[model samples]
Target: MSDKNREGKRTARERMLAERAEDEARGRRRKKLIVGGVALAVIAAAVVTGVVVQDQRSKPETPAAAPAGTIGDKNLIVPVGSDNAPSVLTVYEDPRCPACGIFEREFSPTISQLEDAGKIFTNYHIVSFIDRAVPGKGSKYAANALGCAQDAGHFRDYHDVLYRNQPDETNDAFGDKAVLINLGRQVDGLVTPSFEACVNDLEFSGWVSAVQQDFDKSNFKSTPTVLLNGQPIYPKFNNEEITPANLVKWVDAANQGKQVGTPGTHGQSPAPTSTASEPNNPSPKAG
Candidate 1:
């Protein structure tokens, strides 16, 4: 009776161990499948993201005929009326945006005069949300072209030209390549081959896009959005209270000699002037 009981128990224990081993093997298989699926999903997501970005870079950009102005990055930003200016306004501008243009023409001109007066000095931080328009102004090839122009020493002139001649958002601007080249030519001895090469080169263009993506993550909800003292600038659009004269007078008050657009008065949101095509989607408002 003892031997039979022992044998039965031993057989039962062996079967249990074998079943446990089989179950463990199944578990490993399931784990591997899950890991593999996750990897595939990650890779697919990356590919799709890349494809969408590239597609944006591919849209035909109306090339404004390269201007023959003395074009180049004007490392110097001039805000109107800036004279011994006590306040500083820093701008993050995207040239292709209509709002940005509005910011420039409607808002910035007065400021530029202040700059001219040495009352307030403004610094510009340019970003590219659209692929076309002012070179180095947006995310793709235009940015590279801008960099190239900057390298040649005409960033500001070129920037102004690009904006002055910007086409409608949906319409195309032809001759930007040529305009850029001609403008580059104005620089004493800009490298022609190198300039052309930069325009065609997509690698550096990616750098522009990468920069914009990084910018979007940090600041406001839209392009041409400005920052004052590292905070967002809001221009008050109250018809009576927000006139250009008031802005100038306000800057005068703030600089009581501290760098302020208006002394006690606050501004509404900054305006944008970009009139170019957006990459992927129109610049999403800063969220």
Candidate 2:
């Protein structure tokens, strides 16, 4: 071939080689992209599956259907201890309050002992204000369940179990009505169909509102409010650390005409005209 013709052929050959190389590069890039996309999709699917499984595992057990029985009226006063006890101990508590949970854990045993000993008549006023603060209003359902348990004559047991299993303050662990009924299982003969109906229907939710109204009328603030014989237990309000020992001493002193640490924000004196009564009212808002 002539030199010009040879040059032309060489140039064509070079062009073909370059095109082939480019096509291979493109193919490699496409294959890498396809593999990367598939890997990303698998990882995403695994993440979603893991989340679903974790959620299922974390869910509380479903409650069983129980027999029906009387669940009492809307009076939130579930009294324990002797009617003839020398002193009456009234406590206002919210199921979802962490501080209330702390008090229940640390001090309720002593109060129970005092009640059993006939030293004091214990009255529990279950409230639901924490529901206003936390999501799902679990406090309302828990308090309503308390009333149902009261009718079953196992309020204290149910109350204790609830505090023992108290969920995080911000979380609405009690939102599921089933958990409340499940808790009733802890107290034999406590979780009846009537009780279940009461809880599922928010039966004592009205009573919870009443309890809040009474709390408002009493001019007392906060959960776990303890009043001995109508006198506010100052330590609970005064921010003083309370222990079972101190609580015993306070009761002894009150029995002996002495005042425990002077009332903090709500002052104390010769027991004011007794206004302790069953709760009743409409819904309450968060403070």
Candidate 3:
């Protein structure tokens, strides 16, 4: 064997080893590039997700739509009777409340009479807090139906009918939209397609929520919180029992020198400057 031939074989072996090392280094570089690219893509996705979440958090909520002819702050008041009446009667009530049903049964007739005579007008703030307290949607559904009736120009009639046929507080019968629509049949011209759709679609549900929010913010906490010219008058007025006759007497006394307001087409009225006084009994009760 010659020395030169042995040296050539050794050099060839060294060249093959050098080539293998170069290939391995290139493979490591490629792996690092791929990992770095994936890391960048993940970081970009996280940043985009963060931006979207922040934007959603900062966005303002859309305001609720109010019923037709609603007046007062936040358009929460549902006005019934003559808008021209001299005295204002503010009533805070939940439709599913038993105490409110009793109040309506007792005073509805007199209140209707007074409204017809142009003596006073009523501002109804219908709330749905009962739905939150109870596990039913009766309060919200009933209130929404009332809004539908108001739109149909039969608010007073439908309002009276609901109370007259009100179910037990725990029954949640009014939660059924069909029941509400059937009750609308009692009110003439109140069962039109629009009214039915409103009832079924829960059109005024948002408005009911707004009214409940307003009620929560107000001084009164219970249902059937009645006020006459900003003074608490349910159960009693000026320490006198609130019989139908006594209610007349209280109005008469309030309007002793003032002339009775003329009756006009039913509609919304301006917001009163004075706030309602807190009721003596915060708990709800029938008359």
Candidate 4:
């Protein structure tokens, strides 16, 4: 055989091998695409299933819908800890009040922990004072939004979202209608349609007005007020008791838990123990 022919044969073999390599590469790409698609489908299924499970869990088990016309009040209890909890705490807060925000962030956890353990039951009365901007207008919209959240049975989440995202108290837009709407979206079971409608309804205005009236008639002049049972959990100092840690001090002191030694705070020794059993005010409790 000629040398040229031999060389040509070798070249042909190399070309064929190259083609096979290309084919293998193409096959691998196809397999990769198939695997990626399967993985995506699995992830999608898992997400959907998770959402469904969460929905099932949040649905009212017995469904004793809050009675109609119960706009507010009637021990709207948020279980903090024990049914044997010594007292109910009623907090009147301004969504726009910085002090209130501090209290919500600082003290709420202690109360929440206690509630979860049945040691405390709490009620929240949205005071809507100092609406960040408008003298009275701020609370109106925010309070309306709270009412909407309550109607949706996701008030707890909405309430948390509000305090979690609260802006400075003197500002006007903190709890604006739009802010309320976005906050509603953050909650799992919140109904956007109903929230929008309910927030705008004038029917809930009375409830808001009533809450504010109650505060106006109270012992304290300003907000971030804590009424333990019927007695005020008045702070010894500034609204420093507004922060999460300090708020816990307030609850612990109110509950006689250890004196949490955070700076600028102290625990009050349980109301003299002999001060005739404190009576808690009647208000709507948290979820």
Worst 10 residues of 4 by lDDT: 262-271
Best by lDDT: 3
Candidates' C-alpha lDDT: 0.48, 0.63, 0.75, 0.53
> Could you give candidate 1's per-residue lDDT for residues 118-165 as a string of tens digits?
565454445565543223333344555655565444554455555665
Q: Could you give me the TM-score of model 1 versus the true structure?
A: 0.48
Candidate 4 lDDT, 1-287, residue by residue in tens: 99999999999999999999999999999999999999999876543321111111111122123212222333122222223356666666666666666667766556656565544555566654453223446666776666556555555567677888876544556446766677777877675666677775534665565555555544444556676656555464243434446555656666675322212101111112232332434332221
Q: Mark the regions of model 4 whose C-alpha exceeds 4 Å error after superposition.
A: 1-84, 131-136, 237-287
TM for every model, in the order presented, reads 0.48, 0.61, 0.72, 0.55
In model 2, the runs with Cα more than 4 Å from the true position are 1-74, 234-241, 256-287
Candidate 1 deviant stretches above 4 angstroms: 1-85, 131-139, 174-176, 183-197, 200-207, 237-243, 258-287
Q: Supply candidate 1's per-residue lDDT for 224.
A: 60
Model 4 error, position 251 (Å): 5.3
Compared with the true structure, the alpha-carbon lDDT of candidate 4 equals 0.53
In model 3, residue pairs whose N, Cα or C atoms come closer than 3 Å (at least 3 residues apart or on different chains), thus clashing, are none
Better of 1 and 4 by lDDT: 4
Model 2 over residues 1-287: C-alpha lDDT tens digits? 99999999999999999999999999999999999999999876543321111111111222232112211133335676554456767777778877678788988789877776656666676666654434577877887777777656677778899999999776787988998888778877777788788888876555566665555555545666677666566355245445788778767765675222322111001222233432232222211
